[model samples]
Target: NNRFTERNRCPADIEKNLEYITLIWLDENIDDSNESVQMQRLLYKMNNYVLLYTDPHLCIDYIKTIVDENIILIICASLHELVLPIIHSLNTVRAVFLTCNDHLKLTSVCSEYPKVAAICTDQQQLIKSIHGTIQSMSNQTMSFTLFDSNKQNSTRDSASILWYRLLIDILKTLPHTDQSKNEMLDKCAEFYRFNEAELQKIDMFRTSYTASKAIEWYTSECFLYKLLNKALRTEDIDLLYVFRFYIIDLYSQLELEHHKQFRINNNWDKLIVAISWASNFKR
Candidate 1:
């Protein structure tokens, strides 16, 4: 099943995390109320993958399944004691927002764990805090592995880096086709099922996209940007393969722009710079 199950219900574990942020909401009162529905809609605006769960244990299990993305967990005050202890130690669980009142109890808990954000009793305050925290985390450095050739234990890391470089090269050479573009848009629509704003963006892309505007779409920071950024950052081979349609266009457009940067009066401008032979680029 897709991430957004019927009525934002708890979904089965996703095999991997393919995005920068995931907001997991664990509360017993996730009923069909205006407040709950509005809160969830706001959260979706910040991050597309928002999971709703009533059972603390099931939520924790889902959290454990995520690897590449940072999780922003929102849980009811009642479940904090049982859930916080388990999630606090997990590196993926980056920020935790505890809701409901009892400031005295939460202040003590917050002191013990700095990762736990401020206690948000009011719904508006909770959303504001979550929005700020998500913005902060988005700016924070993403997870990546460094490969050092000098280290003997770097075999795996180094190989993975090489593999990624090779994969990019192969994708750049693949023939772009209408079929590939359709596949990409279909997958995006599936993943962003309940996200109306992103769906509209996707629809626009389907009707108006062209290879010349590949970089524009990539940098728009819309659904395409979020999905592409995640796939590249996580080195998700399967997802990257599906994104081949846009990747080739991105490469060709970059090449076109690079060529244009040197043109003056119908003649290519000469560029001069000093760098050692060991530098990655060669003239």
Candidate 2:
């Protein structure tokens, strides 16, 4: 009865997600007790979509269905040897969290697979591992390419990096309305749904946020930080469209500061401007 509860849900579609990371846990006794439900509650807090399964086969089958989203797979230590080999090569599986009482002993087994992000002996450690893993992935280097008019032969990989830059440049030129901000807020409110803390942060954003303070709100690491980073990491066009209002704001503020720093310098020829796009942009 404690599963999912009535709050902290993104959308009902297991196949689709608004954010990037989808937390899937597989273990026969995953929800066998109230303690299990409490642990899941924490996972759901870290991510809106949390799926718990008892059957490993069902878990693997469902993971195969995921597209354009990163999966954080959680399993008991007992299942490590049996399940790790099967899902190790699946590109969708971003990070694996192994839960067991004797994680120290399982290190050698898990080290064989590069996707195994962490081995946690307890629920608290599991939560910490998941959060840290996602944060690290979100901070991964973005794709970048120097577009040279002199060089006519750019590979598809380089084209993608240039696309990110062009996309941002085009967005900065377009017009964003207040409705964009409201739409983004509405989506955030819906995704967070009944979560009190996130809703409170959203309310604060609505009441106090401004264009000039874009960097501040982003650095606050509130709901905006989480949502924005997830969409950019996955390159979810729909969510990014909703966030365009703030993206332009942030870029404009950055450019303003960038120019301000240049105006004080006499060496204009020596000046250089650098732009960095979003990540797990590493793809």
Candidate 3:
């Protein structure tokens, strides 16, 4: 499923904590009374929301003044490309939910910015995506609060603490090289050497995924062979084991594609060699 958000409903606390949400309705005139009723229903569900009906020609002038933080930007599809420059300028926009059906246009925009959280096919999906994104942001805020509270009593050295902070930031941003991963592991070793108890401090941050899982994601995406070679050269058996499953999964996917092509042309020789190459990692 290409689900933009979780299937689970938002918790009550997050709903109560919502500060403000902004909706930019681009249509200057709505002739249908039923559509107005639907708009009212959506507005009623949102918290402390400000609905701005903008003339398509004048949206640029009005959007310049909106500077609120933690904002969920809901805009009409017609204004998708027009508002992108404004969206780029506004760092306060946490996520974007669009009332758009132009799949190609949506794809192009999302490719440019992963922050375009969801493009709603209909009004119902738009509301759900906004609620989900808000809840996710709220949960992240709560986690940051708890993470800060837990570190209040920490007595680790400044160097170790700095590395720990840097490592967490790197993990959040991801796509770092194997060399960077090795550097992060070295920092962790330094942290452990200074005070073994400090290692437990990362438990809260790892709630999303263990370091192994993060490494698995990285190796699967790019540099799989290079990383495997680096792990062997560095005698990083732990890193090698962490990556084994990802390597195996990649080989399986590749082998399937190769087999399908071979079957079409009845090329038994190439298929045998490819299968043999994939199986060597099993040892």
Candidate 4:
């Protein structure tokens, strides 16, 4: 019954595990008495902190190599919005600690992600809150025999699907130059670990297009709507026909005020060509 004894041991020794805290001090310029520094010193004394002195993006890269689950992420307010998306994308984080006192923003963020349990600006309270959160997460994990593969796989697959959907939407709508497109594609490959062949499948003609086309499309669409209003105002059936069957059908899209300016400028030839180009646009 030695195995049983070990398994049933009281006051479990979590120190034997890979459990640790990740403290990301985002701002390079911070006072000595700042909560980030104070919290860092407090966590350092606990001997459980892994101080990351890197930018949010690079820090995320380092964190990606860690396959541990008991990671408690403590990030500054500036890095919160930037790093949080990456953190949520991973299934490793057990809890989150923020060095922010903005109750309104914290309340909204906490509501969005329940794992964000504490938003502390004071050193003493931050330490206590962190310790308590770690303890609760540790206890919760103790009840489980091991990592839940099914849950992790589900989370990962769902995230991948959403990420892919977003990229595909970007490809269809958001216009980017070749350089930007290639960079985005490269990043996607790196993030998803896809090889060249696989990346090629997603690349298609989407990345080859120019941003000017997208801008023109948006401006044309806005212009068409603007012209449609004018057509209605002057009871111009011919103008309505030109818009319905030609202008809008031919030019692609614009912003509100800019669209007004474009309409006033009467760039009818450009609108026609844009609409024609859009009509010929292929996936």
Q: Pick the lDDT winner.
A: 1
Q: For this target, which candidate reaches the highest TM-score against the unseen true structure?
A: 1
| Descending-lDDT candidate ranking | 1, 2, 3, 4
lDDT tens readout by residue for model 2, 197-272: 8899999989988898886776665777667766665667777778888877876665665567555343211101
Tens digit of per-residue lDDT, candidate 4, span 195-259:
33334533642444343344443233222223333343333444433333222222334223235
lDDT score at residue 121, model 2, on the 0-100 scale: 82
Task: Quote the positional error of residue 99 for candidate 1 in Å.
Answer: 1.0
Model 3 agreement with the true structure over 1-283: per-residue lDDT tens digits: 2111111222221221112334444444432467754664465445333334445445444445544335666667777777776665576666777776665567777778777888778878778877787666644432111123245446543333454344334333544355544454454334233233333433322234343343233323123333344343333545544444343334345446566756534432221134234434333
Against the reference, the lDDT scores of all candidates come to 0.71, 0.69, 0.46, 0.46
Q: Is candidate 1 or candidate 2 better by TM-score?
A: 1
Give candidate 4's TM-score. Answer: 0.40
Against the hidden true structure, what lDDT does model 3 obtain?
0.46
Instruction: Assess candidate 4 and give its lDDT.
Output: 0.46
All candidates' TM-scores? 0.80, 0.72, 0.40, 0.40
Candidate 1 regions off by >4 Å? 1-17, 141-161, 258-283
Off by over 4 Å in 4: 1-38, 47-49, 141-283
Arranged by TM-score, best first: 1, 2, 3, 4
Q: By TM-score, is 2 or 4 better?
A: 2
